[model samples]
Target: MGGRLPMSGMEGFLAGLAHPVIGPDHLLFVLAIGALASTQAGGVWLPVVFVLTGLGGTLLHLAEMNLPLLEIFVSVSLVLAGWLLARRQTPGLAVLLGLGAIAGIFHGYAYAESIIGAESSPLGGYLVGLATIQLGIAVAVCQWCQFLRLSKAGVTEANGSGRSVENLLRYAGFTFFGAGLAFLSGALPSL
Candidate 1:
């Protein structure tokens, strides 16, 4: 299980980044939330809180809590998040935390299921891979939010506005909703 890397360091790292489930849809959702949080609150803490709550939700799924209506919850989250962002409505802290936790359930379930299926390797190595993918998405989202902030503030030569941020958030919500539907349909594997 603790065997040496099968591929070169760079190759392994890139492969980790290329996780199918953690690809575009996941990335966009996280980034959209981050951008919305940054624009509304003018701080990163809220987004960080959101991410951590998501992690907690993932842990819950792994614990086998058997949350009912998981698909409905996820779909609602997407719609609500999109509607809020499009309307430029700043969500309260409680709402943010709740939404983050709910979103985490769906994301976490998928993640835990994937890990269990790929249990051929050392548990530690598998966990590290999971963490790496999650962290990579986080970093990408944060950077994107920062870029949006800079552009909106006119700190950068690039022209960006509130509308652009709103649109991104809306798209993210739609994508998340689609993913939730796919999950519900069993088109995607479940934990």
Candidate 2:
């Protein structure tokens, strides 16, 4: 059920769009990045950095470049992302950008695995699809945070549910942290 490659550009696009959403680790990490970025002034660009690096990672894989312990790196990135969210720390822009770039490569590498045998058209479509969905998710999360006034200053309030948006985001962070640990444990055995 899993070895089949996308047969056309459209198929590749669909597959690429679905890949991040389907992978729990990837989904959580992306969500964390989006939520974290929402707190900063220029946070919207964080996802752009990730998407660009991710594309490069995919191209590197296509060029036969090897990144040892790819899965481990991906899992570790998730752990770091979770930590960033859970702590609610406002990391320096440089530090955050650096982390996003590194993590993007690893995640992108994993993404390329699914399109190894595809032709150029499908590959292009895949890249476009990946970029579109990821950016969409990040922007959506950023907008949501903005709409709810989820800032670092603790000026947010309950959104009709008993908990404030900031509190809910923190909970999301904790969830990502737990999920990352679980993913790391599962990834370690494969090494």
Candidate 3:
């Protein structure tokens, strides 16, 4: 028999937490979003909007509205977001919020796939964990951005370790690009 084993309640919650972390695309998407949301104008609200809009995407998935080439889009989003962060582009609050929401939609839809058939309690816990994890990362990034004075515009002076941040973003960008290419290759068979 190839039947799957049923998970206990706690196991379900833990699995929920682990799901996003398990996928590189998912993790990068969230981290890039966190970096952008933390540093962009109206940073405080953009993350919130991202989370909420992502929830909408989850709803769409629950309704069985699957997006084709989701993996490709997700990987591309990671590349774009990482580029934005690496370049330290200071887009307006609206544009930042829009970016977050767009990325959130796809992420949320992907997130819901693992929790299908979950009970109410575990589902609730999963949603809470998802929000908590993303928000926590966003706040952490925001702290780094503020402390390094990375978010402020028109400052030619490199706040201590600015070079380090740029290097880190560069590495992240390369990784994102590599991952996106991997996804594209994986998807080739289907197309």
Candidate 4:
């Protein structure tokens, strides 16, 4: 599986989309970052670090040096993010950025597994497509969070304001935790 990297632009993009969507942890990670970005400072940099550090991981995979516990790390990060979101904890900017960057490494490593032997051209496209989609998802979610924050949706940070978004986040957090648990127990499958 690791040796069958895509060789075309379309293939690369499809693989990019598949990698994140098929992995519940990956999608939850994006959701966590997006929700955090709108409510926290330097949220904008979270996706950047995720994509870049992930690419670094992909490079490591290509070099044949895998971090032994990458999957466990991914699941752990997902659970922690879910906890933070479930509790409505808005962390400091530095903490958010740092945690997001660390998460990125796990994600990038996973992404790399699919593109192990990709040629330079396809690899470039694969990286761009993956980064672009994930970034776009994060930004779009961030905007949604921002709108909920600013709109007269009859919500406020205090007194259960943003209840809908909060509930969604809570649901997402729970879902992430469940998925992580499932992944850990080998119930659900991942690439």
Candidate 5:
């Protein structure tokens, strides 16, 4: 069953690792976080803020805490994150991290749904998987953006490639924007 707990620690770990990767919305949002962090000072730690708050959110859910219109929050987070990525000028570290914090709560709450009723060992493994994967992805994305030399502004290099990493990132931003809208549309109908 979708709601059933994992039978073992390994299963829980796999499930947690797959959760964000399988969800396009979550995947895009995390990618944007990396892209966003790349342009800011001390930006690499942004994912740490996200992951810590995300763990907090999971704990809240496990405690049976209720967050109203959670899907809406999650969808809106994607929209906000996408908008940040799509913008030519970047915001300061505090602002971006603030957004990441809020988004993390919603995302983590959603993640908690998959691990409900899990044993302590499985739950530990799940948390580790989630943290490791999210952190790794964000760091990798930041490095990739740097490697591509993406400017603070969405500038396309004149290289004959005709497409630049900045353009690709901007395109990704638009994609996330569209995905958020689609998800938001579905979530709103339930309200």
Candidate 6:
């Protein structure tokens, strides 16, 4: 009789870390965007939109919607997000929603592809886990932004009057761009 093999503790730990570490490019993308969003608006809704969009994107990917030029889209997101952050201009809710939705598609695709053949029930659980992690990261970033805003270190007056915030956003955008590039180059393995 054939027997099923169980995962050892270390193996399990590694398996768990795999998704966050290497399975999807979304982790980096999400974090980058979260940092940028925190700088723009210190609210939970922004990250919520990001999470929802990612889930929506996953659903679309499962439906076999081919997002042609996904790499380019991600790259653009990074660039635009960075620009928005660096500029310190207030982004309308509609714009945030649109960006989140578009970015989420790629994120979801990566997640879905990573867990193919896993139990359907687990998919929801996985998404919840993903959302929880993202929320934590977003909150942390928001707190950091608040600290920066309150601090007087290197604070500069810019055209938008939120030059510090803009710098944060620019950094976030560049990080996102770098992450996307790494993913595209296959330097980071996707599940």
Off by over 4 Å in 1: 1-25, 117-121, 152-191
RMSD of 3: 4.2
User: Model 4 over residues 1-191: C-alpha lDDT tens digits?
Assistant: 24477878777877776678677678878877787776675577777777778788877787888677778788787777777777777688788788888888877888787787777777777887788878988888888877776675526445654566667666777777677776665623543
lDDT, candidate 6, 162-182, per-residue tens: 566547557666666666565
Q: In model 6, where do residues sit more than 4 Å from their true spots?
A: 1-25, 151-168, 178-191
Q: Which residues of candidate 5, in runs, are more than 4 Å off?
A: 1-3, 150-164
lDDT of 3: 0.69
Q: Please name the candidate that would achieve the greatest TM-score relative to the true structure.
A: 2
For 25-87, candidate 2 gives per-residue lDDT tens digits of 888778888987876788888888988999999989988999999888888887787777777
Candidate 3: where is the Cα deviation over 4 Å? 1-9, 150-171
Candidate 3, 1-191: lDDT as tens digits:
02232255565556656767778778767666666665655687766877787778777887889788777667677767766766656478888888888888988888888777766776666777777776766667666755555444213334553355455655665676666667767766776
- Each candidate: RMSD to true structure? 5.8, 2.6, 4.2, 4.0, 2.8, 6.4
Candidate 2: regions farther than 4 A off: 150-162
**Local lDDT at 151 for model 6:** 69
For model 4, give the RMSD to the true fold.
Answer: 4.0
TM-score of each: 0.60, 0.91, 0.78, 0.84, 0.90, 0.68
Q: After superposition, how far is residue 183 of candidate 2 from its true place, in Å?
A: 0.2
What is the lDDT, from 0 to 100, of the residue 106 in candidate 4?
A: 78
Q: What TM-score does candidate 1 reach?
A: 0.60
What's the CA error at residue 40 for candidate 4, in Å? 0.2
Ranking by lDDT: 5, 2, 4, 3, 6, 1
Better of 2 and 6 by TM-score: 2
